[model samples]
Target chain A: MVEIATIVLILVGTFLMFVAGLGITRMPDLFLRMSATTKVSTLGMGAVMLAVVIYFDDLVATFHAIAIILFVFISAPVAAHVIGRAAYFTGVPLWEGTIVDELRGHYDLRTHQLESVPLPELEEHLPDVQVLKVLLPATSPLAGQTLAQINMRRRYDVTVLAIRRGDRMITNPGGDAQIQPADELILIGKSAKLDEVVSILRGLAR
Target chain B: MTPVQGLVVFVAFPLLTIAVILAFVRLVRGPSLPDRVVALDLISTLMIGIIAVYAIATDEPVLLDLAIVLALISFLGTVAFAHYLERRV
Candidate 1:
C-alpha cells in the first residue's frame, strides 16, 4: 500500500518538476519564468515530501518533510524577487508586450511636474521647460569641487534635482556637496538654456 | 501490511528520489541564475521526500528531525541566494 502511494507521489512530483523546467525555458521574461517555476516547483516538491513521509511512517521523517515544504513555500517568492530586482537594476529590457511600467512612470512624474493655469493669464505664465540629465564625466572640471565652489545654480541657472553615485541617490544636495567623478546628475531648468549649462560644465572639465 | 508493500514504500520511494536528483542536475546546468536557484530549491524538496521514505522504511520517527533541518537549511540557502542576486546582501 505504501509502495503504491510512493510511486504515485513520485510520478506527480516528477511531472510538476518537469513543468517547472519547461516554464523556465519557455517563458519570455525573467519575471514570468520566476512566476512559473516558484509556484509549480514548490507545490510539486511539497507533494513529493508528503508522499515520502507517508511511505516512511516515521515521525522524524514526516516532520522533516513538513519542514522542507514550509521552507520552499517561504523562500521561492523571495528568490524570485531578488532575481527580478537584479534584472531591473541591470537594465534588462522588459518584454515588448508589457503594458504598464509603473516604475518608469513614477520616475518621470517625480522629475517633471504638470500644472494647469488659467488661459487668461497664459501669456503671463512661463512655459514649463524639459529637464535634462548629465553625467559627471571622469574628466569633468567640477569633479573635485564642492557645490559652493562651483556655484552651479547661479552660474548656469540650473537646479541639481538629484545626484546618483553608484546605486545610491543623494536628494537635494547642499551647496557644500562635493561633486565626484562618474556621478550622474539630474538637472531641471529652462530647455533653451540646457545646452549652455552643459557646455559650461563640460568646459570646466577641460 | 505485506512485505511487498514494505518493499514498495522503501524501494519505490528511493527510486523517485533518484529521478528528482536527475532533474536537479538539469536545473544546475540551466543557463540563468534564476534557473539555478529554482533547481537548488527542487533538490532541497527532494531531500525531504528521501528523509520521509527512510523514516517509514526503517520505522524510525527520529528521521523527521533530519527532514526538518534539511527544510530549514534549504530555506536559508534560497534566501541567501536571492539576497546575493539582488545585490542587497
Candidate 2:
C-alpha cells in the first residue's frame, strides 16, 4: 500500500512539474506564465515532499517535509504578488485581448491602493493647454456635427485636435470633418474649458 | 529498494531533472523581469522536489533537513529579489 502511494505521489508531482514547465514555455504573455509557474510549480513541490514523507516514514523527515511545504505555501503567493506589481509599475504591457484593467485609472502608486477620490492636484500640474480625449456616444448632440458647424473653439474655448473612429485616426481634421457616433475626440484647451467640453460631449449637459 | 521504488527512482528522477532544466531555460530567456523571477523561483521549488526524491531513494533522513533548510533559504531569496524588483531595497 505504501509503495503504491509513493509511486502515485511521485508520478503526480512529476507530472505537475512537467505541466508547469510546459506552461511557462507555451503561455503567450508574462502574466499567464507567472500564473502558471507560481501556483502549479509550488503544488508540484508539495506533492514531491509528500512522497518523501511517505517513502521514508520517518518522524523527523516528515516534520521537515511538512515544514518545507508550509513555508512554500505561505511565501509563493506573496513573492508572485511583489514580482507582478514590479512588472506592472515598470510598464510591462498586457496582452491585447485583456479587456478590463481595474487598476488603470484607480491606482495610487504612492499609497499602493485604489482611491476613488478625484485628484484636482493632478490637473493643476498640467499645462494651460493640454489635450484630452472623450468618446462621443450615439445619443450625444455633438456626434453628427462637423467641426465648423460645432464651432467648438468659439463656444467651448476648446479645439478638436483629432478624432479616433474605430482603428483610424483623423488628425488636424478639416472644418468639414463630421463627428461620428462612437468617435473618440481628442481636444486641447485650458483644463477648465476641457472639463466643460467633456461634459457637453458626454451629453451630461442640458 | 523494491522493484516499484527502483522504477520510480529511475523514471521520475530524469523527468524531474528535465523539468528543472526547462524552468532554467525560462529563467534565462524570459522576456520580462517578472517572468525571469517567476522562473527562477520555480527552479528552486523544483530543486526542493529533487532533494525530496533523493532522500527517499537513498533512505537518508538527514537530507530531509537539508530540504527544509533549502526551502527557508529559497524563500528568503525570493522575497529579497521581490523587494529588489520593487526598488524598495
Candidate 3:
C-alpha cells in the first residue's frame, strides 16, 4: 500500500515539474513564463519531497524533506517578483495586451530609482505652473535649429526662459537664436508638457 | 526489484530528465536576460525535485542535505542577479 502511494506521489510530482518546464517554453512573455513556472514548480517539488519523506520513513529524512518543501514554497514567488521587477526596470518590454501599468512614469531617470510618489502634476487651483530645466542631447532634432523652427510655444506649450551654454547664459533669447549641441534650456510650463519637452529634447519619441 | 522502486528508477528519472532538458532549451533560447533568469529559477526548482527523488531512490537519506543547500542558495542567486541587473543597466 505504501509502495503504491509512493509511486503515485513521485509520478505526480515529476509530471507537474514537466508541465512547468513546458509552460516556460510555451508562454509568450517573460511575465507569463514566470507566472507559470514559479508556483507550479513549488507544488511539484513539494509533492516530490513528500514522497521522499514517505519512502524513506525515517525521522531525519522526513524532517529534511519537509524543510526543503517549506523552503521552496517560500522562495519561489519572491524570486519571481525580484526577477520581474528587475526586468521591468531594466527596459524589458511587456506584451502589447498588458493593461494597468501603475509603475509607469514613477522611475527617476537621474537616480534610476523607483519613486515612492508618482510624477506630480501641478495643481489647477494654483496660479503658478511648474518650471523645469531640460538639457538637449546632441542627437536631438531641436539641437541644431532655432526655437522658432521647432515651434516650441505652439507645439509644446512651453517657454524657454534662459539658455545656458558653456557658462554663457542667454536670458530670454530671441526666436532666431540657434540652439547648439550642449545648451541647457530653462523651461517654464505644465509638468506634463515639460516632461514631453524633456523627453523630446533627450531624443526619446514619447 | 519492487514495482515502486523499479517505477521510480525507470519512469521518474526519465520524466525529470526530460523536464530538465525542456528548461535548458528555454534557458538557451530565452530572448531577454530576465526570461533566461526565470528559466534558471525554474531549472533550479526542478533540480530540487530531482535531488529529493534521487535521495530516496538510492536510499541515501543524507543526500537530502544537498537539496536543502540548493533551495537556500538558489533563492539567494536569483535575488543577487536581480540586484545586479537594475543597478548595472
Candidate 4:
C-alpha cells in the first residue's frame, strides 16, 4: 500500500516540477514567469517530501520532511517579493499587454521613491499633483542646456517628466539629457507650483 | 536491486533529470535578473524533490535531513541575491 502511494506521489511531484519549468520558459515577462514558477515549484517539492516521509515510515524522517515542507512554504513568497521589488526598481519592463498598472504614476524618478495610496483621512494632507505640457522656446535660457545645469528639482522642488521631441517621447530623461529648442516638457508637481514649473521650463523665471 | 528500488531508480530519477534539464535551459535563456533568479529558485526546489526520492530509493532515511538543509540554504541564497540586486540597481 505504501509502495503504491509512494509511486503515485513521486510521479505527481516530478510532473509538477516539469510543469513549472515549462511555465518559466513559456511566460512572456519577468513578473509573469516568476509568478508561474514560485508556487508550482514549492508545491511539487512539498509533495515529494511528503512521499519520502510516508515511504520511510520512520519518526525522524517524517519530522524532518515536515520541517522542510513547512520551511519551503514559508520562505518562497518572501523571496519572490524581494526579487520583484528589485526588478521593478531596476527598470524591468512590464509586458505590453499588462493592464491596470497601479504603480505607474506612483514612482518618482528623481527621488526613486514609490508612494502608497494614502488613507481617506490622510489624503487631505497630501499635496495636489498636476501635469503640464510646455514647449521649450528656441530663445529660452534653459535651452541648449542639460538637466544637471538647470537644477530645477533642487531650486523649485519640481520633478520634470517626459519630453516630447518631434514625434518621439523621452521618459525618465537622465541628468545629462539636454533641453532642446521646441522640446515639449511634461511637468508633474504640486498644482500650486505649476505656475513656477511653467515659468522655469519656459524660461519665464528670472 | 529490489523491485521498488529499481522502479525509483529507473523511473523517478529520469523524470527528475528531465525536469532539471528543462530548468537549466530556463536558467540559460532567462532574460532579466529576476527571471534567472526564479530559475535558480526552481532548480533548488527540484533538488529537494530529487533528494527526497533518493532517500527512499536507497532506504536511507537519514538523507532526508539534507533536503531540509538544502531548503534552508536555497531560501537564504535567493534572499541574498535579492538584496544584492536591490542595492546594485
State which candidate has the highest DockQ.
Answer: 3
lDDT of 3 by residue, A1-206 (tens): 77777888999998999889988888888888888888788898998988887888799999999888888888888888888988987778777687645565455444556654322564454344665655566888778889899878899898888888887999998889888876878777776787788778878874
Name the weakest run of 10 consecutive residues (lDDT summed) in model 1 chain A: A105-114
Across B41-63, the per-residue lDDT of candidate 2 in tens digits comes to 78878888887877777778788
Error of 1 at B21 (Å): 7.1
Error of 2 at A44 (Å): 1.4
- What DockQ class does candidate 4 belong to? medium
Candidate 1 per-residue lDDT over residues B1-89, each given as its tens digit: 65534654655465555546554665766656655666676566656656555555565667667767777787777777766765532
Model number with the top TM-score: 3
DockQ of each: 0.28, 0.43, 0.78, 0.62
Cα-based lDDT at residue A158, candidate 4: 73
Tens digits of lDDT, candidate 1, A1-206: 77777767756765676566566656666667667767876777776777766666556556666666776677667766666665554445566798754443123222332233223453346465545656666877678898889786897777887888888999999998888987777776775566567656666422
User: Comparing candidate 2 with candidate 4, which one achieves the higher lDDT?
Assistant: 4
Off by over 4 Å in 3: A110-206
Query: CA lDDT of A166 in candidate 4?
Result: 85
RMSD of every candidate to native, in Å, equals 9.9, 11.7, 5.7, 9.5
* TM-scores for every candidate against the unseen true structure: 0.52, 0.68, 0.71, 0.69
Per-residue lDDT of candidate 2, residues A9-111 (tens digit)? 8888878887888888778788888888889988988898888778776788888888888988998898888788777766677887886554642454434
DockQ of 3: 0.78
Model 2 residue runs over 4 Å out of place are A116-206
After TM-score superposition, what is the CA distance of residue A185 in candidate 3 from its true location, in Å?
14
Error of 2 at A21 (Å): 1.2
- lDDT, candidate 3, residue B72? 93
